[model samples]
Target: MISIENEGKVKHNKSVATKLTPIEYKEITKLVEAGIYLNSSDFVREAIRDKLKAIKVVKIRDVDYEIAKKEVLGYYRSHLEAYISEVAEDLELDLELVIKITNELKKERRLDEV
Candidate 1:
């Protein structure tokens, strides 16, 4: 399991920012009234943080994909049965599902005919 180091920390900087239009303000009011958040800033910050973390996770995974794929490909070449078992073991995947994915990879020409 890959663990990500969350270096994100909250900074306390109080600065008055821009104003929203009436309709935008009303939508923010609705969100506050919905009892889901304390205020608009809370809502916006949470939304931004969630979106940022999602993008970060994807970026981190993307950085590792090529190397991981290369290792998977190597195992895929040498001993297919062992490779499938290894994938299932490492990912805690179901045997049937792993086999299905392996078959699909072969079908897609991602894996050589063995």
Candidate 2:
């Protein structure tokens, strides 16, 4: 549920027939009828705002997810190789523990490349 300025109001949008797909328009109508939004315009505005917010945060267009993923997954992409190489050089010590920590760090820093 959204906190609208006027909860039970149907404020019309002063648009010149913005062409929404039939499914999109129907979904908005259903949400409005179910009281999920103040009105159709509010629903549309919120949807657009949310999408824009996601785009602003994640600049998906300029990002190269595939290249970054390969670079990240590769051994030499980060300083990660230094740690791995150290383990490889000193194979007498059990390296399994360090591998576990490396997996966790990958999950954390992968988003930065994005």
Candidate 3:
């Protein structure tokens, strides 16, 4: 059994066996000695979680970008600032990024009002 401390809570779970190359094993051990990770299993689990979160964020950002692009095109000429602010707030994204994307869309002539 292996235990990991997560958010001040101790979680106990059965350990799964995994084989690591010599270099990888050494890296994990060094990280442990450096106090960067409690153990190899915990480090691997955290790394996997971080990677999955990054993948999810990329997918979500893509969807948000498309939606923002459509919204920008809709209210671009008439209410540019309002629409930009609204999209930024709704998507919980950086305002500058929203503005930059909108500018790019405008420059490409992809956001002409119908």
Candidate 4:
């Protein structure tokens, strides 16, 4: 059984034990000696909290990226013909390239009625 001291009270927790290298142990000891943490356990607990928070942020960012990607793709898929026509008119585009794309869209039945 593992115990964590919370507000002067020790609470038993189902914790897994792991061994750290001598160097890692020394670093935690150094942190405590420097008064950075009350003890190695508190440092480990805070480190775990920080790591979990970082993972949560990354997951949220990935979800946001996926949502943004879907919205952009959907917009392009629904407005491809109009966007192509507008681009060809509004920009100095290569005639050959434009013709090739227009032909491809025609084959795909995506070109608007001229």
Candidate 1: 10-residue stretch with minimal lDDT: 56-65
Steric clashes per prediction: 0, 0, 0, 0
What's model 1's TM-score? 0.40
- Count of backbone collisions in candidate 1: 0
Model 3 agreement with the true structure over 88-108: per-residue lDDT tens digits: 666656677788877888789
Clashing pairs in 1: none
- In candidate 2, which residue ranges exceed 4 Å CA deviation? 1-17, 57-114
TM-scores for all candidates: the values are: 0.40, 0.36, 0.42, 0.41
lDDT (Cα, tens digit) per residue for candidate 4, span 39-107? 988888899889988873111122343343343334446665455434433333433444555665567
List where candidate 4 sits over 4 angstroms from the true fold.
1-12, 57-114
Task: Provide the lowest-lDDT 10-residue window in model 4.
Answer: 56-65
Best by TM-score: 3
Question: How should the candidates be ordered by lDDT, best one leading?
Answer: 3, 1, 4, 2
Angstrom error of the Cα, residue 32, model 4: value is 0.6
**Model 1 deviation from native, Cα RMSD in Å:** 10.8
lDDT of model number 3: 0.72
In angstroms, how far off is 102's CA in candidate 3? Answer: 9.4
TM-score of the candidate numbered 2? Answer: 0.36
Model 3: how far is 93 from its true place, Å? 18
